[model samples]
Target: MVETGRIRVAKDKADLVKSLISTDGATGPFQTFADAIAFAAALGAKHNRRVPLGEISKREPSPIRLEYFASMGHDCVIKLLAITETKDIKILSLTEESEAKRNLIFEEYANGGLEILQNELRGAVDYSERILLMLCPEREQQEQQNEEFDLSKFLS
Candidate 1:
């Protein structure tokens, strides 16, 4: 892990991060930019969307640090994403190159997820409620799927 370095958000999505984080008296759903990024990365991975950051998109106002991710226990998410993307556990090797690869995968997924969120949150009155509304359907569908796959009941 690159302990001393920062994790960056795409320049295009920086404003979106600000809108979603709770710092500076913002009423966003997440308490910190790292939280939002982790959520976005998961969202993007769920949708299988990974958008690489262009030269123009990787700029100033980089959000969280590598240490913050480890401290907050989000490093597991990074490792999971990296391993899933490469389909090899070796991607989790403790080396600078491996860490860079992990961060790149994370950043791209986050960018894609942020794009989805931007469209979803546009013109919303409250971000927290909007996020909850987004999650409800997914949970319902998952529950329905679970009920459909209850094979023990069928056996009985």
Candidate 2:
């Protein structure tokens, strides 16, 4: 794949992203900004929301370099989301134009996911706990579906 520049989050969601990241003494669910972005992008893709970003602030919450995602093993997530969105395998082509398009799609989905997270996390004192709570229902549902194995017929 071609080298791209920085990946940007929606300006409006910058504060939300900050709250999700765990710093020196902070206790957030994500260890890095890239982790939070990947989560938001996945969330957006799950909800089928692709919101375009608005005016970005000049300072704070700096844009993440493309290399960070690759180093974090999130490069595949970008390519996967891009291919899924466009329903075109050609998006995987190793070219600058293709890479740019993939990044654009990923950013929009991440922005949308951030919006969803912002609404879900509102009025929360502990972000980590709140995120866990958000995940509980799905976990519970999966547990409920996991029935114990039965081998009664084998006894015949």
Candidate 3:
């Protein structure tokens, strides 16, 4: 029985970049959104709770995650977005992009599924029997569309 928290939405470029890092700066970088999800899971684990992807993604960008992504420049960020939108992006780094992007890439493409789930479960809220697994969903997920360039579309 896992208590899913909320999602963290990356508002701007900075926020999106921040979402790709681990809090402690001890690990290398998040290869996929699932790795980011694992980071969220790690965060929840550290606090003895389950943090929802929706909640984690929506969290405002803080200096805590490190503005390291900013230093990578727009070209790098574009590449990251492409990776984020990649279909079947793994929770772990299955590609060389991990080392190339400095580990700021994400895997899962969630279309803000939290609200949808909540709506379906509106009647009987039984979370105790549920176990949320962080996965690299086949679908594409993005917090918001970037005006600059979507790597997935561009590369395609």
Candidate 4:
């Protein structure tokens, strides 16, 4: 598995794109529909041992379009643009919303809301890292193979 020091939550599409590109083995800037999908799949495979192939396959086959999926936290959202064809599958872009929230929390901390700001900051870093790790291909593969991957043990 690819081990990066720490994953920072991406603040926008541009930042997310930059991080994905910065990963080892990513070639050139991913600027097209095909490039983004290929990169996401590769990144997913590298870190997570799995990719969200099932999620991609279940989408309606049609022209490319942006879609969003909600995650555990209200601030966490997965966004993607899917391109589907009879023989080819592609995702133009994929990003999460936690970075925006991270910024807000940072602002709050700066503004003297120490209590709430501290709590938010505590989880933001780890949450963002987990999001990135979850994108790893190895993780995705493992998830697809075992429906019963337990989290409780790890948590406890």
| Top model number, lDDT | 2
Candidate 1 residue lDDT tens string, 1-156 = 332256778888888888897777789999777888999999999999999766423443464777878888888888899999999998988878888889889988988898889999999979999999999999999999999988888774
Quote the lDDT for 25 in model 2. 81
Q: Flag clash pairs in model 1.
A: none
User: Candidate 2 regions off by >4 Å?
Assistant: 1-3, 146-156
RMSD (Å) of each candidate, 1 decimal: 3.0, 3.2, 17.1, 18.0
* lDDT, model 3: 0.33
Candidate 3 wrong stretches, greater than 4 Å: 1-7, 10-84, 87-108, 130-156
Candidate 2 per-residue lDDT, tens place, 14-108, comes to 88888888896878899998999998999899899998777653455677888999899988889999999999999989888888889889888
Per-residue alpha-carbon lDDT of candidate 4 for residues 17-58, written as tens digits (9 for 90 to 100): 333232455433433332333344333322332211111121
Candidate with the larger lDDT of 1 and 2: 2
Highest TM-score, which number?
A: 1
What's the ranking of the predictions by lDDT, best on top?
Answer: 2, 1, 3, 4
| TM-score, per-candidate, Cα-based | 0.88, 0.87, 0.22, 0.20
lDDT of each: 0.83, 0.85, 0.33, 0.30
Q: lDDT at 65 for candidate 1?
A: 79
The candidate, 3 or 4, that scores higher on lDDT is: 3
Across 29-83, the per-residue lDDT of candidate 3 in tens digits comes to 4543433433343333323332123223334442222233333332343244444
Candidate 2 vs. true structure, TM-score: 0.87
